[model samples]
Target: MPERSLAAPKPALIEKVLMRCAGQCAVCRAWSHQTICESCLGLYARPLPRCWTCAARLPPAFVGRPRPQCGRCLQTAPPLDRAVAALDYRFPWDGLLQHFKYHQALDLRESLLERLNTALSAAEVEAPDWLLPVPLSIERLRERGYNQSHELAKALARRRGLRCKPEMLLRVRHNDRQAGLKLEDRAANVRGVFAVEPLLAARLRGTSVALLDDVMTSGSTLFELAGVLLQAGVMSVQAWVIARTPEPGDE
Candidate 1:
């Protein structure tokens, strides 16, 4: 009789072991059941005063204000009615986001979503009528294998028991990269790039929506999309981003 080969461990069992064992925190290298660990989250991701419209970090003096608005936003409001960010685009978060966005580090999604959800809860943000992710163009979607914003929106909708309308917004055209571009140029870069799905446009009429994205730099992309949504009769548009870029030279 031929000897039988030893059975290999199942993928589910290996996943279970990984979940049970403590792993190194991405920030402090501390052993933890979480990716970023609770301590690091407390220190690095503590809520701070942010602009009501753009989610920019406000001066410490504005800490207790009911609605903190940054000076830039005060001069001219952004398209978004409100915006909230889970973390700043800096340090360890920048690196981690890069890995998640470009290298397919899908495991980081849970911890990232946890931080965003906690921030949203603490902010006492009202649930919108729908959660819509800023869509990617066909070429980019094929290249990336996933829409990061859609993934975030789906996870957030699940946590909040809200509707996620991924198909409601569509990226109709490819735009130049906004990095290193001036604010006006960035705005121009994204203009006319987004449109609402004709079939579903009526459902969005007079309904508020929250847009989910991984990061906001100049925020041109989100603002542009918000304008399109508003034109399609969306009552209000709010942005929920995983991170916001700090002001220039603002350590």
Candidate 2:
């Protein structure tokens, strides 16, 4: 009889270390199981009252304004119906975001979800029928090996028991980064860059969808994705992102 080879043993040291450090963020000393420490999390992530329509930070004067809409959204309505952000993208938070998006810190998904979940819980909004992550271009996906937004959406859906539709919307163009661009240029950069798959369209008909993304800067990308969903007959499109960048000259 031929002798059978045994399967290789798993690494026990790494597992032991991770277990000991459970719910602790090494960077911020936050008691988190995944990424970011609690102290850093509190210092970096803080909630802000924002315009429901555009997710822009609400100025003190605008606090009492009924159904407040930002200047940009008031002049030209965004494609999406509503937007929600978990925290402001500034300071140490921005550092974490840079690391996650550019350096590919996959473990950051846990912190992202924790922050998003808190925001969702506090908001006075109904859950959507479907959750769709802003999709990446095929070429980009091939290079990155994963879409960070999709990963976060999957975790969120699991936590809330909502259906996560990863293939519903897609980025058709590999456009340039919008980080440093002017707001006007950002809109043009992302215009006509997203489309909904035909099969996915059928599933979205008359359904409410929550678009999940890691961050909302100029919000051109979310607007573009919402346009595609609306064209596909989605009843309403709402956006939920981990962070929102405050525009200059806006309080």
TM-score of each: 0.91, 0.84
Candidate 1, residue 32: the lDDT equals 92
TM-score result, candidate 1 = 0.91
Model 1: clashing residue pairs?
Answer: none
**Residue-wise lDDT of candidate 1 within 46-69, one digit each (tens)?**
887899899998878988898789
Candidate 2's residue-wise lDDT over 118-169, tens digit each? 9889776678999999998888788777788887898789889999978878
Where in model 1 is the C-alpha error above 4 Å? 1-20
lDDT for 13 (candidate 1):
56
Give per-residue lDDT, candidate 1, residue 10: 68
For each candidate in the order shown, give its overall lDDT on alpha carbons.
0.87, 0.80
Candidate 2: which pairs clash?
23-32, 23-33, 24-32, 30-37, 30-38
**Count of residue pairs whose backbone atoms collide, per candidate:** 0, 5
**Candidate 2 TM-score, C-alpha based:** 0.84
